[model samples]
Target chain A: MKTIQKQAQALLCNSLLASAVAVIFATSALADELNYSNKLLLTGGVSQVEGAAGGGLTPWAVIGGYGTNNEVGGSVHYTYVKTGDYKLDTYGFTIGLFDRVEFSVAEQSFDLGKLRNKVTAGLGADVFGRNQLTQTIVGLKVRVAGEAILDADTWMPQIAVGLQYKDNDETDFIKSAVIGAKSDHGTDVYVSATKLLLAQNLLLNGTLRLTKANQFGLLGFGGDKHDSYQPMLELSAAYLLRKDLAIGAEYRMKPDNLRSPANDLLFGGANVVDLKEDDAFDVFIAYAPTKNISLTAAYVNLGNIATVKAVGADYGNQEGVYLSAQIGF
Target chain B: MNINIKAATAALLATATFLMAQPAIAEVYAQNPNLGNTPMEGTATFEAFGGKEGLVKIMDDFMIGLVADPRTKPFFDNNKQTFIKAMLVEQMCELMNGGCKYPGRDMKASHANMKVNREGFNALVEQFQFAMDKHNVPFSAQNKLLAKLAPMYREIETTTGDAVPPVFPKAE
Candidate 1:
């Protein structure tokens, strides 16, 4: 499975290269007809961790690029997050068509570091040996109603519906009796509404998601304790300081799918370390030096992931730095 | 034809009733004192642009930038640039509450034949921002004025296709 996923990642890279070449050739031929930079600066939002066009945490209703209603635009992004006990690296690309539909693909690698040793000692060497968990997310979004920019004069907002299918590579470990995950794959559905109040230089977004994944699907989907879909809410607010700069904060509610009685007994015996999942929050600053590129840096807190009482694996209330860079048309 | 006219009349009446029923419509109308919207409150926003004279200089640079940018040059080059600049000055002055009344026609009537599109509109906005930055206008003040003008895109953009500059009859 790891080799297959590696091959898939290689294929994704090759396809991205092919698409970039195609875009270059297409641009010269359709330069006059297709409008490239029709949307205002920073209005398309930056690429989120899961390859969506949004803030650092959750997807917004706006499309992924600077395209207007009559043009096509896209972006490529890389994000890095370092926490007290783990490090996550994400890279992805998105294609937005006619400012109405968005298609995205992302690959995330979560490095467990020293925690791998603790898990191996507790659950036996054969149960867990890998130092990292890798997952691929493929997403699709469609603008359902309203316009974030054109309808700025009114109270209307842009609304969109999106879906993400996540596949984790660590199938055997996830299905083991220790982890007890029902599956290594799952799907998430969400609806988002975003409004850009230009008069006040403010942007607000709200997203409602239904999912069964644990730790954003990095720890696989479902579990022995709870396997049903749960609804989560995410919110973001941003203030435009300048045409090229914005500051924002986000809060994302997550489901505690792995903290049931059975799972707690296995991972946190005698209440050594409660394995309850907590919400995620972040405050970010995004800067666009030019229309072609943007940079985002944030302080993020991703609360508790599989806490076990050990020398170096007490991963609770994780706080870290998030950095991302995006390049697009 | 008679039925079609009657249906149109009914639709117009329904729209009128809907507009009249909304209490917020009254405030919107009252706020819109002129085509440029009501003058902004307080003199601080006005002074930030260096007052009326400062606006004139900004308009000059704005027109020059318009003519130089490839995306917007076709619309301003060889057109009635001096008159357009004067109208812009008056519009900005009135919007900033600088004690000036804009004498030009409303936005829709003036831009009816320009065939403007999203690309052209955005280009014009970029050039305008560049001009304001050149004049050292405060960014916040620029945004306040932009907030007032951004909605005018509804009246200015007439098509989704490529922008086509209207050709005025040559002076005899």
Candidate 2:
């Protein structure tokens, strides 16, 4: 399993490098014919952790690149997040077509420091030795109604529907026994509405998602407690201070499906590990010095991931700083 | 050609009626009060541009920028440069409710012959922004005016192809 994991990582690194080279060549070769970048700067939102165009935590309705109706565009992004107990690194790329459709792929590697140590100590070192969990997400979105930018005078907002398929790399025993996961993969479907009140220099977005993933599919999908898909609401609001600078806040609801009292009875409730999930939020400032580059820094609050009473390990409400950078046409 | 005369006649009749109603208010008669988008609610925005004098200054720089920008040069480097600049100033002044009215064709009728694309339209807007910046217009005031003009893209951009400037006979 370790060898397979190493090989998969190596393969992924090689493919990413190749794709980067190909994207650079394609952009330069088709500079005149494609990717006109007619849209205004920063109109294409920064890439989200799941590779969608949006604010820090939630996906907005805008496409992922600065493409207008007659052009194609794309972007690449890297995000780093650190909490009191863990760290997350995400990298992704997205392609936008004619300002209507978007396709994205992202990889998230979550380093579980205290949780890994506690679990390994409790279950013995040989049972679970991995220090991190990784997941791959592929996303597709299509704009269905209205225009966020040109419709500045109207109440109508841009609406889009999208889906993300997530696959986690984890052993069956670790998923089923440690996290009580029913599956290692799942899909999340969402619909988003975004409005840019150009006169007020404000942008607002709301999204409703149907998902069954646990901890964004890093701990796997579904759960022993509740296995049905649930609706989660996400919201983002941004105020443009200048043409190239914006400050925003986001709130994303998360499902609590891993806390099972029934499973606790198996251990006579003596060593129950509470897995109640909490909603996430962030306050961010994004700045673009040029059309091709954007940087974002945020204060993120992702409440306690899990707590193990048996090991006396309580991962306090995890709050930390998040930083992201993006480069694109 | 006949349609142009007819439209002109209709506009003149409308202007006559408007003049009779507010006889003492306007120094310059107009073809249509509707030439600009809905007039802004308050005089504060008009005052922000220093009234008509400020608009003239902005338009002067704006025309130069338009002619210099490669993407928009074809559209503005024409024989009717003075007329176009005057129309823009009047349109913006009336939009801000500065006691002025525009005597120009509406957005669609005027740009009908030009095949304006998104790229060209955006380029024009960028140049206009530069002109406003050069004249030290307050950013918020600039945005207020932009919000009124931004929707004109619907009427101005009529094609996905490269923009082609319309040819007009020089004034006799």
Candidate 3:
């Protein structure tokens, strides 16, 4: 617990430092009163879950923030999601430098709800249900090829490669008992292709990720059944209703690496629990009232999470609402 | 319980139907009024801008804006604004299929001696956008015209003599 708190504090300090630097840059640019125009409006997508620029669930090729090709821009975002059995809150900051590179840091807190108490009682351990599980993620992305807005009429799509390193706070719980994960830290590497059809007001993104993260690192990384890297696909499609408003859908494939053990050592054989991971999908609406602020709302479906069939406590298909608010220059 | 499920299914279907119908409705409302019932391409763009008279006005206003800009004023110092304006009008008319001929020199030949840089060209484009906005040209119409002209950048931007080599070879 102390380690987790320290890590969280470190993350907060780093975020503040990054913000201070961005403010200094912005102040200097303002002092000059330069008309630094670069990219088109709304070409930079909203911040993603991990603080990268993209849709809510998946990262896209475009960098985050409003910075044109010659200016520096940064954004801070807060996101919340509530489901039948779990709740997740994420807060982060992302910076785009000259529209070329993006750097982000986000802290996620996952609340396990009644399942925490059930797991605690079943395992007779004080660790479960004691506190919310937290994870800190640091991400970096670089635009490699093509341009979303400039190449709108061409067959080529903008492409970017990124990596997110995640560190979960609860190391012991993840290693020995829950899902038998090998480590509390994992890194996800992904390549994303994005295209903007400006004339039709349509945007499309496809991402291929190599990861072993379970529930986005909230449940830790790499299960006993499969610890090696696995490939996953995420796709997003959005239609701009207007220059400032967009409606989109995202689908993300999750890895199902947790298999039921032959005999349970933690729980009695009669009350053995198995881990099940399923793909997630969402339909979202994002509205940017101004260039500096945006609000996003979505209906999300995160399928069966940490279900125990023997206990008759299937969390079922987790469906709920997601909301995010972002402000940037 | 059965009736409840039936009602839920009916409601879901209705919502889906309504959501699916939204795009078609939005398309109708989002249509550009300035298009004037013409297809959004080719000669129709010229027609939408009111043909020759409209082209003349746009060129006149654009030249005025360009001259007012300090960054671009130096480029136009040697030429008469009237002649420049007429040539631009002819070029735009020919590009938009206005049934007018561009009697002036080609883009590369005319710009070869100017040594125009990217920033200078961008300034001109900004001025053009301002002129179109001043004339109340619709945003979509402006973009359509600009898209057609954007390909000319390769020919017009010839800074540092990289685009066209000298006719006489340098002595070794």
Candidate 4:
């Protein structure tokens, strides 16, 4: 029996050797080259996806992050957006170590116009001046069951699940007794999945978030008073208009917890076309100038501030446009 | 009109010359039995591919590219140009056309001295493609040539301590 076992082991080793030899011999006979495709012909050189900023993913832009070959990459972003007299300066960054892991950090500083503005006549320019808010997230993504690489000439898209931990910087509005919260910092749990159904032609992605944080950091309020399981969702669809160009639209939802002179749901979970709803729509275009860089621009219609509704919900509309540039090596 | 025997023989000779100049016919993969076959040279392989001169032309172009690619610029710059080119030409030709004998070193022996990795090999292959495109070679002819060079990686990679991938390691 021992001799038989030894013989089996030897046979296995010899078989492996033969297979290796066969592969080498076959390669020698066939002609292959040295370029990415020349060597094994798999695609390489990942670039940024330039486009608009949705409440869901814009923060990921401030830092440098990108998507890798069915893996992970990161990008650093500087963005500018204008809503009426409000000029928003946003800094964003996100990184995906592998396709299964992600992390993001970002900040937004709002420069609310002069003192005489009707909206701020009560607080006066001194009390209602410009403020900065920073948000950072650390996340772990996993492909419990999915493929990141597309099969040759087929449409079996890959899928993955991710959880993001978020930190927010609070402002005096919440610290000054408007909302009753021990702390402004909170965590957001998100599970997202994406698919590239058409060999770079089309992509469909969406995310669901359960969080205690209030607002996207626009108001003085922080997380829910009693740790309410606030819900946030983002749906985005992208299509390759050209071999290296893409255009997409995103619908993002946020939390409503602005409790200053408290009305109903304070934060107003969303903004759109100045319509005062709980969501916003963003349209963006990404231009891949090269294999290593991309430029994106978008238009956003974030509705009315729900708080103004208490004084009669008819506080006119505020529209804005956002632009960003992305670089990858 | 008078029938001229000399003119008739001259016509036949011209027709024969034209037939000899024609390229090989495209083979049906199912019937050829060479499909998926490891690129090995046989007496029949020689006749099917063009004669010695044709096979040599392919090698000549392939070598010129190997030496010219900027990516592989280091390969030639670092090695003795004449020695490398001569051996490459010999191995490639004899292994394909079978008209000549392959008398070069084994894959491992030839590359043993060079710590060539996947990246290095890729650089060389790119140059070959640039050379082929410049020469306006057809894809079919290129395939016929590749079959013979594909098998060297096993021995070559083993000797160099490079990662052994099923195909060339271009993407990581």
Candidate 5:
């Protein structure tokens, strides 16, 4: 546990240092006459959960930053979500170069709330006092084909490939006891196709991810039951009410690795808190008053979060509010 | 379970209602009050732009902007600004179905001798967009007009040769 904490801290520090260097390099290369060229305002999309440019939960083909083909741009975002039993906060910075490649670093902290006390009491020790699980993710996205805004009239959708490396801080609890995860770290690869129907004022995106991440690596990675890599699908559709305001919905399928252990060997059978992963969806509204800043609010349904029973109900159908603020150049 | 179904039904109904109301909402917002007129396509947009008078002003501003831009200035060099502006106004009037017949030369024939490249054409478009912005033309209106004019790219650009001239003369 101590070793994992030290490694997580080191990784966070390194990510911060790298991001600072990148910012300095990008600022130095900026020109005086900043122009967006053929890019439409706010078509670059906002940062997603793992800090890639996309919808709230799924990554899209559009790069995160405001940079056009001729210039460099970057953005910083903070996201917050609160459910009945857990609270999640994520903050990140992403930089896009020539609208071709994007790089990002994000940190997510999940608070288990009162479940921490219950779990510790059940364990007959202060074992789960450090219930705040922290995960650091570094991501890269490269545009491979088409253009989202310029080719709005065409049938071709913009496509991009992305990779995210996630590292979790809590290692011991994930390894053998709770979820039986094999590792504390994993890599996720995804390809996203996004299209903008400018004439109809609609946007659609689909993403396929190859991953073995459990609960997006918050619970752990590669569990004993279903540890192999699996392909996941994420879909998003949005309607632009105006050039600046958009309402959308996103559906993301999760990997169900926890199949309920045979005996009550792990953590009591009925009380064992099943890790039944379920699909999640959200209805979101994004408003961009300017080309440089955007505010997004969403009603999210993250089904069956950490299986913690609360208020005479399991943590199934976990409904929550998601809010995010993004500022870019 | 009953409450869940009721809540779900209510949400669906609200979504359906909002979707049905969108077209009317779009109609209300499309008529920008700041522009002092609704910018519709076809004859309505032409009349809203003040028919011949507004077109002449737009052409004048567009010509001024073109002449001032270094990237597009060479294309207009040696040409009389008033003559070009008059021809453009006529072309725009015809394109907008403004009940005006354009007596100017066709786009392909006029630009074939000039050997206008894509960059030059794009620069001119940029200048036109700048002029429209200066005139406080609504964005939707500008795009409506631009969509009609955009098809002329193939006719106006690169009719003779593929070689593109540099904006500035090369020094010895």
Candidate 6:
């Protein structure tokens, strides 16, 4: 059984690795004759959080300076988020078409609690089990409104709609089987709003998200939201640190639904334990040395699960820091 | 003082004449049979910039000062999770390098709606000049760079209701 789990994990990892190659092929096949801006790539704007206290997404913010170049382009980016023992790492390539549409393929690996792994079935131990989760994701974003890179006037928000398709895989043998779904797929739809407030040399940003992925949980195992709605709010403010640089902070909130439906088995319904968590806070700092590349670092603090600790595992989840780098073609 | 003024005028005329001669040299260099023909020799890169290695340090130092500048302070002072730094570094570096198509929007399209006046524009340019100076960029190179970037003003500045580049040229 242990060997079987190892083999399954290997196959998934291999497939995920291959998708990087596939993304490149898809891009080439679609548009063979396009010379996009070889110009400097632009990084994330001022707003650090989702909902802006002052403004929303502007046209310039949506395309990251690409929209101004009047062409299509692509980029390779890597992001790493760490909280004590918890880490989420992503590597992906994003392509923009005439600054109208953007497509991306990303691979995410999450290590929960960075906890110790003990293979007791006499298999000794490998770096296999700090409870890592890997996901293959494809996302599409469309710029929907507004003009002007900076609005000295009232906040004219630039809005975009995006969709992300996520596929998840787990490693542990016992957990995978109990998950009832070793592999699962989820779709997320999101709307983002950004604005650059020129008066204060400040930028305000925010986003609205609706998803049913059970909070990016284990082995793609998400609780049935019963089509329930979860609302997340993020507010960020960026002050031009200099002519070419900006630093900002963000405050965000997540869903609060983590528990099993009582007596669903006795009631004769398909039974699945629902484990989710309360809202958490994440604050980050970003730096753009130029307009072409950007570096972001942040710390995330997730609140404790009052009910979960009563069950079995001690998530002891505290906080972690992350550094992310982005490039635009 | 009168003698010094006369001397400076003569020197200025000489400089103008020298600058005029350079374009001719560039043309002759293009036709020269001695040196292997390079298409670039036909035109004057020197006319736009001091030379090939001009913009590098100027660009770098401008950004370095930008990150340290207090006038532009609010943007990144409190950042913890954002990666704007690396982006700007690469972008500015690319801009300094010749002919890289900047993927960003037009200065006007990006800044038009933002209403930057002469004062704001002057402040921004001052920062740029400081950065270039700190990096030891030559005066000619600085002039050339400014010439190339001057037109971007249409995108970021207003003339009628707004203002132009020289916020307040000292009264002679």
Off by over 4 Å in 4: A1-73, A98-100, A113-120, A123-130, A134-149, A152-156, A175-183, A220-227, A262-277, A306-317, B1-172
TM-score of every prediction relative to native = 0.87, 0.86, 0.72, 0.50, 0.71, 0.52
- Name the docking class for model 5: incorrect
Candidate 1 runs further than 4 Å off: A1-36, A121-126, A260-274, A310-312, B1-36, B169-172
Question: B1-172 in candidate 1: lDDT tens per residue?
Answer: 0013344345445433433442221135243344545667877778999999999999999999988888888888865888889999888888887888888887888987789988889889989988999999877888888877877787788988778887864223
lDDT of each: 0.79, 0.78, 0.71, 0.44, 0.70, 0.45
Q: Which structure is stronger by lDDT: 2 or 4?
A: 2
What range of 10 consecutive residues in model 1 chain B has the weakest lDDT sum?
B18-27
Error of 1 at A249 (Å): 1.0
Q: Sort the predicted structures by lDDT, highest score first.
A: 1, 2, 3, 5, 6, 4
Better of 4 and 5 by DockQ: 5
lDDT of 4 by residue, A1-329 (tens): 63465456446534643553354334323323321222222111112111112222432111122333232444445667675545566554444454344444444555544212443554443433343444433444454433322321222233344444544444344454334343545555554444444323455555555555544444432433333555565666766564356778877666554334332334454221121234556787877664344666778766544234322324444467867654332
Native contacts recovered, in order, as a fraction for each?
0.20, 0.27, 0.00, 0.02, 0.00, 0.00
For candidate 3, write residues A30-71 as lDDT tens digits.
Answer: 633544233344568887887788998999999887665556
Q: Which stretches of candidate 2 lie over 4 Å from their true place?
A: A1-17, A24-36, A121-126, A171-174, A260-266, B1-36, B168-172
Which of the numbered candidates is closest to the native, going by highest lDDT?
1
**Which residues of candidate 6, in runs, are more than 4 Å off?**
A1-61, A64-69, A113-130, A171-183, A217-229, A257-274, A304-313, B1-172
Worst 10 residues of 4 chain A by lDDT: A42-51
* Model 3 regions lying over 4 Å from their true place: A1-37, A118-127, A260-263, A266-274, A309-313, B1-172
lDDT of 1 at B162: 77
| Model 1 TM | 0.87
Flag the better candidate by DockQ, 2 or 3: 2
Candidate 4: tens digits of C-alpha lDDT, residues B1-172 = 1123354345445433432443222323232222211234454544444556544565566666654664354445433555555665555555554544455665666655555554446456545644555555543444345433433343454423333323222222
Worst 10 residues of 5 chain A by lDDT: A30-39
In model 2, pairs of residues that clash are none
Model 1 interface DockQ: 0.15
Sort all candidates by TM-score, best to worst. Answer: 1, 2, 3, 5, 6, 4
The CAPRI class of candidate 4 is incorrect
Best by TM-score: 1
DockQ of candidate 2 compared with the true complex:
0.14
